[model samples]
Target: MLRAGQAREDIKVVSFDVDGTLVSPGFVDCVWLQGIPKAYAEKEGLSFEQAFEYVKSEYDKIGEHRIEWYNIDYWLRKFDLDIPYERLFKKYEDEIMIYEEVESVLAVLEEEGYELILSSNAANEFIEFQIEPIKRFFSHVFSATSDFGEVKKTNGFFARVCEILDVKPQAVVHTGDHWVFDFLNPRKIGITAYYLDRARKRNVTDEVRKEDDEFVISDLSELLDDPDC
Candidate 1:
C-alpha cells in the first residue's frame, strides 16, 4: 500500500494540509485554545478560567516558531482585543470539522487530474474561516505563515512550493499531520511526501526519518490506492 509513483504517470501537484490534514484539529484548537482565551476574558475582566491561564502563558511565550505564532492578526493585535478577527471568526466558526476523508479525498483528487493545493501553516487570515467548507477543492491556497513568510514548513518552504507550482520536485505530492511540517519538509525537496499518522500517533517514522521510508499514510483513502498515483 506504500507503492509511491506506482508506474510514474508523473504525479502533478497534490499538496494539502489544512489543519490536521484537511480540517479537524477542532478549528485550530478552538481558535487557539478557546478563542484567544475567550477574547482575553472579555477584555481583561478575567475568568474564562483566568483567561485560559493567562492566554496559555502568553502562548507559551510565543511558540510554534513565532511567525506571530501563525498570526490571527497577530493575536488580535497582541491581545489589545477590541475583538475583530471577524468576531473571532464568527464565534469559533462552529469549530469546523470537515474531515470525513475530506470530501471523498477532494473528489478523488479533483477527479484524478490531481491539481489541488492548500499547503498550510495556517494564516491566510486563519485559512479563511476554516477554508470555507473545502474551498472549492483548492487549486492553490498556500500559506506557510501567510503565503511564505514561513514560520513553518521549511526546506525553503518546499522550494517555494516548487517555484509557484511550475511543478518539478518530482511533480509534487504531499500529505500532512506534521512529522516535521507534513513529513520532513516536503521530503526535503523532491516532494512526494506522505505521513498522515491518524491517531496511530507516532511510530515516530520508525524513530527518526527514513528507515526504508514507507511513505506512511494512515488514510486519505490511501491516496487512491496507488494505481500509479
Candidate 2:
C-alpha cells in the first residue's frame, strides 16, 4: 500500500485507464455477450451463451483488430441475426452508467492544474458513447482501437501517451482497475501508479499487488481527501 504524502510539484499530467477504472456499471462484457449476441443468437435458434462463446472464440483467434471490426458489423452476419448495428449500439448506450465517485475526483484533479488524459482499451464508438457524459473532465481522450491500434497493456501504448503529453513517465501518475495491464506495466516503464480497487472486484496475488504505489478509495469522492492532491 502507498503511504500518504504530497504529490510531486513537478508532475503536470495525469492519465487514467477507462472501463473498470472510471465509469464501471458492470454491463460491458456481459452485455456484449449476453445482451447483444444473445438477442441475435436467439433469433437464429442458437443458445445465447454458446453464441457468445463462439464469437469470443473466433475473436481470440483473429486478434484485437478483428474484434474491432466485429464490433462494427460482423456479429450480425456471423450469427445470422437480423439486428442493425445502430440498434445494437443503443442497447449498450442505455445500459451504461458512471461509477460512484468519478465526477468529484475529476473535479479535484482538474482544480489542481493537472492535465487529464483518458487512455482506454475500448473501441472508438464505445469511447464516444462514454464521452458524452464526462466530456468536460479530460484534456484528451484516446482509445486503443481508434488511436493506437492496440490496448494500453501492449508495448508502444504508454510511450505514445508520454509522447503526446510531452511528459516523462515519472512525472505522471496512472490510475486504473486492471492489476497487470494498468498498474504493473505502467510502473515497469517508470510511471507512478494507483490502483482503483472499485468494488474490490479484482483479486490479485500479493506479489503483484505490492507493486502498486497506492490503493485509492473506491469512490471518487475520496480523492478530495487525498493529502497529495
Candidate 3:
C-alpha cells in the first residue's frame, strides 16, 4: 500500500521506537544476554552460566524502570569489567539486525513527505551504531534515556520531543512494540499511536478494537495500510 508523495498535511511527523520496531531484538539480546555476561564471566573467572545468573540478578535489582538498567557503560563500570564498553559495540557490530519491512516502510513514509524520526529508550551510542544503514532516512534521533534523563514511558520525553520538533502531539504518529510505553503513553498526550505487536502476542488490539481496530499491528507494512499513518 505504498503511496505517492502526497503526505497528509495534518500528520507532520512519524516517530519510531528502535528495538523490536525497526530493529529486531537479536542485537540487543546479544549485547545484554551474551556480551555482558561473557565479559563478566571472564572477569570473575566464573562459568558463563554462573556469570549470567549474577548479572541478571543485578539487572533485576536495578529493573527496567531505571535509566542505569539500559546503560552499557553503567553496567560495564558496575561489574568492574576489564574490557571497555566500546569493545562490546565493536564486537557485536555484526549482530545488528533491522526488521525486513523497515526500509520499505520508511521509504514510503519518506516519499510521502512525512518527517521521520527515531525516539528510543536505548542509549545514544547503541542507537547510532545499530541504525547506521538507515540513519539517512531519519531527520532526528532522540534517545529518551540518554537525552532527556527519562524513559520512553514518561510524558516528559514525548513532550520534549514535540517541543524540539515544533509539532503538536496530534500531528505525530508513533509505533512500537511495548503496549504501555509506545501506545498508551503517546495516546495520553493525543499522539496517533500504534502498538506494533509483530507476534500478535498482545491483546491490545482486541481491547481497542471497539474504538480503533488498527490500534495494534502484527507487521510494519500494516502501517501503510492505514491512510493516516
Which structure among the candidates has the greatest lDDT?
3
Query: Residue by residue across 83-185, what tens digits does model 2's lDDT show?
Result: 7756766777766777767776777778878888887887766666765777788888877777777744553677788888889877777777777777777
Question: Please, what are the lDDT tens digits per residue for candidate 1 over residues 81-194?
Answer: 877777767887888887787797778778877788888887887776787877888878888888778788887888887898778878888889888888777777778787
Q: Candidate 1 at residue 202, lDDT? A: 77
TM-score of each: 0.34, 0.78, 0.90
Judged by TM-score relative to the true structure, which candidate is superior, 2 or 3? 3
Q: Which residue window of length 10 is worst by lDDT in model 2?
A: 1-10
Candidate number achieving the greatest TM-score relative to the actual structure = 3
Model 1: CA > 4 A from native: 1-8, 20-23, 32-35, 46-70, 76-78, 81-118, 124-145, 148-162, 168-219, 226-229
Between prediction 1 and prediction 2, which has the larger lDDT?
1
User: Can you write out model 3's per-residue Cα lDDT over 12-64, one digit (the tens) per residue?
Assistant: 89999998998887888888899999999998899999999999999999998
- What C-alpha lDDT values do all the predictions have? 0.78, 0.67, 0.84
- By how many angstroms RMSD does model 2 differ from the true structure? 3.8
Alpha-carbon shift of residue 186 in model 2 (angstroms) = 1.0
Shift of residue 63 alpha carbon in model 3, Å = 1.4
